[model samples]
Target: MIKDRFSDDDDGLQPLAYNMSHDEGNAANTETLHLNVLEDVHIFTTQFELTHKLNVIQKAALLLQSDTSLDDAPGLSVHEITALANETTHKWQQPWTMYLTIVVTALGAIGQGWAQTSMNGANLYFPDAFGIGSGSARDNFTVGLINSGIYLSNGLLGAWLVAPLNNAFGRRGAVFAAALVSLLSNIGGALTQNWQQLLFFRLILGCALGVISSTLNIFAAECAPAVIRGGLAVSWQMFCAFGIFVGFIANVAVYDFGSNAWRLQLAAPFLSTIPLLILIYVCPESPAWYIKNNDHYDRAFLSLCRLRNTEIQAARELYQAYLQQSTKHDSKDKLTYFKTLTELFTIPRVRRATVAAHTVMISQQLCGINTTAFYSSTIFLDANFSKYSALLASVAFGFINFVGAFPAVWTMDTLGRRSLLLLTLPLMALTMLAIGLSFSIPADSPAHFGLLAAMIYLFCAEYSPGLGPVPAAYSAEVFPLSHREIGTSSAVAVTSLWASALSLTFPTLLNTLGSQGSFTLYAALNVVAFVLVFLLVPETRMKTLDELDEVFAVPTRSFIKYQLTVYIPWWMKRYVLRRDKVELPPVEGWRTEEYQAVCQNEE
Candidate 1:
């Protein structure tokens, strides 16, 4: 009699469990397939679940929140359930990692800026401090060459090295490597005599720096809980702001040194050592990497607890759950370097996500954000401000950028991805139009209208929160969890290339097209981007990867849902109906009311 009762219960969960099962041939025991069906139902039925986030993590998080102890947790294996739940549901605060990582990244970027800034700013202090030999052509060539090196290293090599470096050295290792290379490069830049030598070393330094830029983002995501990921990731912009803050002070203090001012400016970036040490001592390796190494579960658990400042056994349960999810996402599949390379190309979602990441990156750079950032000092100089005031304004740009980034970060989980990205183009384009128009006026135009210059600066501030961070966030997300590392490296690589192009060309482009023409062209491209955002992109905010996968994996053609069959693109279809496969009889009227009874009977 009991055997017959259990059989009826099995019929209840068969529909949603279909894809979850390993084989279509196994029509048998479909009830056991989903493993999470009952779990998910229990969760969504609760009030705590975010209406926005209705996926496995949300379910697990809700489940753990209700359960008091690991032994009492309503699941087998407390370790696994707890880790996954805490990241999605229980939000814990830890500044050790978040603050340190941001500071370290910020300091590292300053070192990179020193390589370019004062020397370029030479046009101000010692007009002949470093003379440009010829007329416009020679001056343009020198600036163009310096820009080229920055682009090639970051664009071409940075992308290629990001994955291997991270995999081989771990995130910490990569950052350490960047610091060491930066130390050497800053020293070399300070000591160099010729333009060609300085350019070569700067490019080398840029390549090394590029590696750090590409990987730090992925590191931030893997370490942070989903709730705080955006907040933590935006720390880079803060650090970047601080770097500018420090650089401005350093530039002004040493301007009296004439040519020597450039050397002090060059070496100043390595001063980020204080934060770098904190990161090295306290920051934990990603728990995801521990699972990747197989059987290091205990160490992995401790790392999470330490990072989150949680109790050990309590952290263990959560770490285990996280391990399982991470496992599902980052399958070992013989994690060979070569295998990593080929899988990125062979996987469809991986390829698509990579393309999206790359496109977002190219657009951010080509849209003229970096050039605007790079040349702001020049623009201020052109406005007839004293060099120190221009330096002050450059530092101010960092603060505005930092402040601007907070809105995007706060809204990322609240607002949809498509909406954030779509909204960017219109606002960004208008700002650029103002910038170009400001430059269109005669040289004698009063500094009072410099509000337009402020708008150009505002455009950059706007870009980071919107388009600036989008590419990195997208790279960390877009692919199926299984190939995320490889997929992201590839996506970032393309962007690195785009960064290189921007660095190399922008100086020349600015000179050739002039500010009015340059920004006008980019503004026109923003219109096309606005259209693409509406036509192709889907909302990603407040949703899980699995939800995104379900949403995007479908064909963007006709979709038929029961009577309310609203027309949606094939890609937007949330559920798949296997027409060739069998369908279970409806849960009848009891599908809703009978859930508790049916599940209770199964137990």
Candidate 2:
């Protein structure tokens, strides 16, 4: 009778057994026997505790069933079962391997930074070497094309190329390929004998940089723990700033090397690529990517184990949680390129995020950082500094940028993204105005030169902390796992487009408007960016990617008010206020039941 009953119960338990075994590996025959006995216990338990009770009872029953001396399986003991249940669910600390992964992956950002600024100081000499006169319309046009060509390629081709490659080769493979391209491109630029060759190599180098920029942040964010994900992801931006600083120092060092100094400057980015290649080889692929895209669940689980510093069972649970959230929108059919791009704009929350991300990226370029970075030396020269002095000033600005980025690493999660941007953008606008006013003074005045340098450094300082890193981090965090690749690529493409436009028009704008007029225009753009951010951008700090998606899905009016009146003021009081006695009153309707329901429904 018991045998017949057990056989009858097996049919009911089959699905549960499969689910458990799918996540927790065990021998087929042993698993079946264990699950049969567990299912018997589960049948009698309350629905709420069925699974937990079954695990506990089955573990104790296995011990009793194993002992042949037991005439029958011993009756379940509540205390022993409870102890086993607690033991089963106990979590271990995350391992050092996860931290190591973030550190290694972030190294690629240095190469990206180097590639960007490599042309900055070197452009001072390009006009003479390429035989392009400074003042003529055709020559300036060619100069603009050569300077902006990389960004044009980056926007038009580079990030688009990375999407399919990222899907096929995995993030690590994509990074390695980008590094290899960078190595060869930098070498080619170093060996170039003519202007055409330099332009060709730089265009190719831009392609490499676009792939790295799009992939590295997503990879870091996917692998990191939620608690520190923003910090680790933005570490790429920090490293990029560090690389630009190094590039500036290299330019300063080689300025005295005469005619070949620019060649050496062009070649310096390859050094960062060498370390990037080495690190990618040693790192593991993104576990989430493996599971969602490749359907390699076991490998994904193992990768998660290493990344989370937990045992297999714990990692399995975490992976399952991620899968549940991610698979809500996943289709069984493979997504085509056109379908993916269409979906990015069609989904409401995703579309909102895409628009916000696009705005931030475009703002980064249009707010005049690229113009400041690419033409700092030129600007200093226009301000009456000697060539060496201009190069040295550029180096000083790079150092300020590098140093300024460090504070974001500490405050990104604590202060929140919205707070950082609100705090910095106003100051950035003021600094731009200060710079423009300074330039309006006589070029020979000591105050004119001193204020120009000071405001430029201040602009770099303001930029690195918020505008520089937060947008990239925010964009990387906002996308769902399914759309992350294409969505981030689109953001990068917009960045490239705006950067190209700014770079192509900068020389002409500088000539037509002069320094004071160009800077005043930038100040106005900053004011516009500040208003857009205040109205649209959400506070995404300390929230998981899944949580952020829900946050974005809420209506814009309620979300913006929650950020401005409730979240920001509370954050300010806690971190910024630093006073023991003062406590801000909470705003009503901030976390009302209706708002919570909306977020939950969207999620």
Top candidate on lDDT is 2
TM-score per candidate: 0.73, 0.79
> What is the per-residue lDDT of model 1 for residues 307-350, given as tens digits with 9 covering 90 to 100?
56334333444434553564464546556777867866655445
Candidate 1 lands at a TM-score of: 0.73
Cα shift from native, residue 421, model 1 (Å): 2.3
Residue-level lDDT tens digits of model 2 in 1-603: 011112223223322232333324446775576567555545533332333233333333344445312222223234433433343363223467776666665567777777767788778887788798566767777777777877888899898987888888998899899889989998898888778888898889888888888887777777776545655767888888888889888888899889778888889888888888887857778877776674664466557667753232333343344436555765736678879889888777888788778878877886899888888888999899998999999999989998899999888888988788888888999999999999888888889988999999999999998998888888887887668888999999999988889988888888788889999999999999887887777677677666776667765666667667776677778888786666654322357786767556654
- Give me the runs in candidate 1 sitting further than 4 Å from their true place: 1-92, 95-135, 312-335, 383-386, 447-449, 555-603
Q: Rate the local accuracy (lDDT) of all candidates.
A: 0.58, 0.74
Q: Candidate 2 — which pairs collide? A: 95-309
Q: How well does model 2 score by local distance difference test?
A: 0.74
Per model, how many backbone clashes are there? 23, 1
What residue runs in model 2 are displaced by over 4 Å at the alpha carbon?
Answer: 1-96, 312-318, 321-329, 332-334, 556-603
